[model samples]
Target: MSAPDPVRCAVIGTKTIAGQHLPVLQTLPEAEVAALCDIDAEALGETSRRFGIERTFTSVEDLQTWGEFDAVYVLVSVLAVAEVSERFIRAGIPTFLEKPPGLYSSDTERLAEAARETGTTAMVGFNRRFYTCLQAGREALLDTGDVVSVTVHADEDAGDKWFGEKFPPEVSMRWAYANSIHALDLLRYLGGEVAKVTSVVRKRRLPKPDSFSALLEYESGAVGRAIADHFGPKGSSHWYEARTASAVLTSQARSSPGDRLSSCTLERHGREPVRFGLTGLDRRLKPGFPGESRAFLRAVQTGEPVSFPAPTLDDAVRTMKMIDEITGAEEWAPKPAS
Candidate 1:
């Protein structure tokens, strides 16, 4: 059978993450980035020139007026995600939103409700959930048996300070939801929704808590634990592990520095371990971008649910709620005298 025609995608932001996603979307056989949009003309021009995207617009109103693309990728700032995405969703156009989906879970809730009310297909980009390594590890774990436990380690050196120069005070104050959700969401993607907080410890180094550790019980009867500290010497890192009765699956977040491919290993007793390394496409594009873009475009083309593991807006809402609960368990204490 012949392959389906590509979905025409119009990207709504032209900086940083959009820059990373554009090339990957172009590389997908199922997608064609037909238009680019950004309020900043210079950034839009630079991205349009860099990617050779000819159709460009300076505003969502202008893009909607043109209305030529089949799907839209809302890569706007964290604060603007809901407002921008709601327009596309309510218009009945397939919408793909970049992560954090909003500054808070409430924003995600608003988008989810809009999607349901309009019966539009909307997905949120939780790129880590699409990492090839994590996908392989998850499949292997599920094959072994029901997942009994999961452990995730997420840390960033000076994360609170890292965003100070780049984002507004509001975004900086809600740092965990804006950024750490990338790793924390993995807990739900791999294990399940956190049913209860078994225990929690939090430390505030700055205005917001900078370190957290928690034990959780999942709705699936599985147990999970996570430790997130922003005091590491390295910039950022994530480690994931999930266990079943027969095997253990572990992975280094695909975006980790110095790793060209997503590094994953599945170990089973009385059998040789299996390594789930990068595919050719992963090596060529951002580690997970090809899979992520393909998943979204596939859903747009077939009018199907997003491919397995790629989060729809509703799934992202769930992840955001979990993050809210986890980060809400913060505790403040006076610093020890040095």
Candidate 2:
């Protein structure tokens, strides 16, 4: 009998996250980074050479039509994600789209519809749920009484141009969508679906609004609060904590030298706080990325179901919708300078 065909995979963008994705794909025995696509030739060249990829395409159409990849990792900006993802989904390629699928709800819904119609499997890159501490936290919450309130603190000194030049200028201010999206995904993952939100935004020192805090009410009668700020003078960082009738979960605020850390700690009411140790998943071994990638591939390969903790497409849409509402409300806007 012939050996099963290898899973050919392509990376759709060469940005920072792609930096994360490419390394991981290399570790999967069943997967290969067959193609690299990016509008920037220089970035494409760098990635192609680093990964030893022979095929590189500057256009999405060309890459989608010419590549032999069975799956694609869509790691481009949220604005461009829908367009590129739709192309791959329509082509019958399984996809692992980066989180917060698109800048708007309509776009993400359209992408979801395309995936459904074409029978293409898709997964969102909400990586935090896979963190060891968080996984244990969820297990702890199962027997604990209903969650009452949650507080998430995420601060990153994302230097100038932290997200790179590809992101649309308007949405670049602060990490309301970029960084907090992860926490927002976690909030829903732990506390339950958010039913309403009231928020306020501030731009203390940065050119764009760089700080925000919100109050969230969940469908399960739980309450949540979240803060995302980029005004720190120190290096990048992140922290999150959740409170329930039985326990509390916390995460240290620390990011890698150049990369943001997404770690957490879960503190039970009467027990010690459980810390998800530094994810030793080397960028070389592609630990976290490969872990999620392999899980997705296994689900596709075996027809088994893959479950996610938070920020599913639907959950992300709900979070984005809440952000839109908070950002648009006159009461939530910053006051005019005196």
Candidate 3:
């Protein structure tokens, strides 16, 4: 195929995270915001003008029923992700979806099947894997040897940002899938496959009973755990970390909506105790989004699949299974016939 012009992309949500995505998409050399879609007619017009998007719609159906964008990015609500993604994937439009593909593993099955049938590329949002910190963590594991174990922590201040409804309920619990999956997938990303998960669930900080710590037994014979809380004291650190025999790696970002300051620390112990930390990181958007979006653009333009991308739908399903076990639900397992 000939070198394609800049990938004309359409974004389907203009909410909080989508707000960040619009500007970042505008900055990518291989991307152009061809259209914007949101249920809020007012917000749609505002984002379209804000991003200089010429075409706008208040519905994904209108965008897909008669749309012409080169690719689609499904940034809709968690409950609506699979349905929206399935619409585009069956239409054979290369799609990039946001995190937590669905509240349950079953929710992702049709989209995965459709992607296979249509031969269209579909990717889930797992930007943490692309973070420079986790990127180095994977390599740093080589020196550590044996993949002993890993630990990840996430802290959120629900002080005033606590809307209590930013995320809807699955009635089966969406907190872990909503984001603990970020750290869960991170553990899997750096440590390897998971064999078993044992987690304690309880309400610690948040307005909801969604905080807990989980022990992970990796299929590679390594042990790890991750803990998250949405309500913490103001200025609490929100970061993830992993440790190896030779060194420990940590990633933390300063709290500023307008600007980003992140750092990764590696502490080594041996003949010499050396400490390495990377500072002044991009914290506004996800550290890995640019690279992730670029990979999508490459795949869209070349008609090739994204190579070893982080957090595929299947991968998210496996993580969801682990979460199910953590919640004592075990929804991923084959059930007994009624």
Candidate 4:
């Protein structure tokens, strides 16, 4: 049979994250960047010109009215994700939403409901799940046996350094959901559905809860530990580990220095460890963006489900819910200056 037509894609945001997606989508054989949209005309113009995309719009309604693309990538801010992605899902277009999928688990739930009601395919862009190193490590871990335990240590500067008076209260207060979810999702991705949060320890910080440690029990009887220390002295670092009886897998953050690529290792009993890392494409574009973009476009082009590890709206809902469990909803709410 002849080659399938590329999936014409429209991007709904032109910020840093959107820039990351656009490059991969344009390079993919299965996708075409048909149009670009952003409320900020200057940013839109710059991104459109950079990518050589002629079609541009300042509103989602205008883009929908034009409706020339087969799939839409919603890379808007955390607050706008649910609203924008829901519009496309309601309009019967496949949508690729950036991580978090919404400001809260409820927001993701609403999007999931809309996708189900409209019968449109939707994916939440948990790019880390698409990391080639993580993928290989995950597979190796499973080959050894069941995943008995998984640990994720995500570190960042304090709340002031993170927000720096830039984000609105809504976004800053929900920082864990808006940002930390990227690291937190790895827990569910590796271990499985969390049955209960057995213990939680939080270091109270005024504007936001800056440190947290939680013990998780998964539905598969796996134990999980997620520790996010925003007050750490280290600038920023992340380590993800998953273990089976016979093997262990570990990876550094994708943005690690010297190569801008994650380093991963898999070790089995009585065997030398197997080491792997990201490809040049990952270094060229944002790590994991290329794979995640291809997976989303492939699903759109062929009507097949977005491959495993690329989270769907339903999966986002669970991940977000897990965030709520790890960091109580009350703590995420911003308080007025004293």
Candidate 5:
């Protein structure tokens, strides 16, 4: 059968991460940026002009009324994702939501429930799954044997600049849930659902905790460990290492944000170590922005959910469940008014 026409898409949020998404959509023949939305009128106007998008709005209400788009991408702040996504899902517009899907399990659960009832498709952005080395490593690790253990090491140097001053301290303390989730989600992506997670955190110079280490047990009998620190000097980031019965697969994140590079190394019992530069991964491997966008487009076009290299809301919710288990318990969720 022939494919469907390109989806006219609306993107909410015009910030740093959304910037990464723009070029990708421009490259995809199956999708177009039909509209743009942001609360900040200046950013909204600038992004629309820069992208040559004729439609722009400052709120979801305005976008829904006049914006003609079949799909939407929610790139708003983590705190805002739940409320924003609920609106889109209820409107029956298929959406692509960014990572740290929601800070609260309740919020994410509500989103899943709304999507199901509304018959709206929602995908969570977990871009790490598209990294070629990680993808190839996951494939080989599973093929070799049961994945016994996985270890993720990630660090950043965000310093004391988190949340600025407007947000409460509780939001600041959820640093682990906000960032290290990428590592945890990647573990679940390869090892199946997580059964349990225990975390030990240390607070240092930062407003919230400065570092955290966690141990996770997956339902597939695979165990995983995650260690993250924002207090690191610099040139610190994420890496995933998976060990199967016969071999071990490891992926290293870029040493610095200025460089777009990640390396994957595979070591078998007696074979030579294999290394791959994920920077070489194009849209085909689904590495970075384009790869993920391509994955989203596939499901949007085929009307089927993708799991291998791409993921749906179900996968994202499960990851969020695990994240809430470790970091965003009731204490982290928002409280009622007085």
Candidate 6:
């Protein structure tokens, strides 16, 4: 008997994030990167050639029609996320949209409704929840039931060009939406769903919004603090810490392009402050893009669950709502200068 055909997949948005998606799809034994699409023809051709993808298109609509893949990885900009996602959903294709899901709750809700009506699998890409350290932390905390507070610090050297050309003044406010949503989602993943958030945003150094700090009150009576910054010196670091009554977990490492990392520290609380020391795991925790792609393929083939702790469309919408609250809060208004 002939073997079953591999799952045909196409990647939309051939940017840096799309670069991550392409490799992941190629690694999946049950999936193949059948097509690639990008507004930039140069990028489209480059990625297609590099990845050995034969079909390429400059428009998602064209790609969708020609490629006819079972699923599409939507990795475009925040502004384009919802529209592109809705298009595929209406076309009856499952989609794995990169994080934030959409620019606003309304857009996300629209996509969510479409997914439900079409009965297509829609998963949001919040990859942090898939990390080995995070997975261990989740299991440890759940077993102990002693987590009280969690603190996280995430800093990105967005570089001058990122703030200047990537985000203009009019749309700069979305920096918080596009970047910090992952950290905010992490709070919900680790602590429990956030009940309320008090947040403050600041713009420093480069123009546009760049920094924010928030306090999250979780439904389980746990409190967490999250800080995200993109305006920092080059070679900056990403640090994350989770503490419970019985243990404390920490990771400090430099973030590479695409915010990937090399190493991290995991600590267990002891009588005097014993350090567990630094250990090196696979630089690509969760295998970054490839791991997620494999998980999606598995879910499709065997009816197994996706490996990552992904946000549903509804969960992503709610996270966007929380971001809106933080960004639009009256309490976060700037004080009068002396």
- Top-scoring candidate (TM-score): 4
> What is the Cα-based TM-score of model 4?
0.93
Error of 4 at 336 (Å): 14
Report the lDDT of model 6 for residue 303: 54
Greater-lDDT candidate between 1 and 6: 1
Candidate 4 lDDT tens digits, 1-338: 98789999999999888877888887778888899999999999999888899999999999999988898999987778888988899988999998778887767888899988988989988888878878877887898899999998766655664557656677766777777787789998899999998546465654556677889999999999988877745655667888998888888546556422277888887899898787667867888888888888778878888757889888988888887778786554633343
- lDDT for residue 171 in candidate 4, whole number 0-100: 75
lDDT of each: 0.80, 0.68, 0.69, 0.82, 0.74, 0.67
> Which order, best to worst by lDDT?
4, 1, 5, 3, 2, 6
* Model 4: how far residue 134 lies from native, Å: 0.7
Cα lDDT tens digits, model 6, 290-310, are 545655666666654444366
lDDT: the better of candidates 5 and 6: 5
Q: Write the per-residue lDDT of candidate 2 for residues 163-242, one digit (tens) a residue.
A: 56755554455256665666656667677778888877777766666677889888988898877666667644555667
Return whichever of 1 and 2 wins on TM-score. 1
Ranking 2 against 6 by lDDT, winner: 2
Model 6 RMSD to the real structure?
5.2
Better-scoring candidate (TM-score), 3 or 5: 5
Q: lDDT: which candidate is best? A: 4
Q: Estimate each model's TM-score.
A: 0.91, 0.82, 0.84, 0.93, 0.88, 0.82
Residue 217 of candidate 1: its Cα lDDT?
91
Global lDDT for candidate 1?
0.80
lDDT of 3 at 10: 90
**Model 4 lDDT, full chain set:** 0.82
Q: Name the lDDT value of residue 235 in candidate 5.
A: 40
| Cα shift from native, residue 132, model 4 (Å) | 0.4
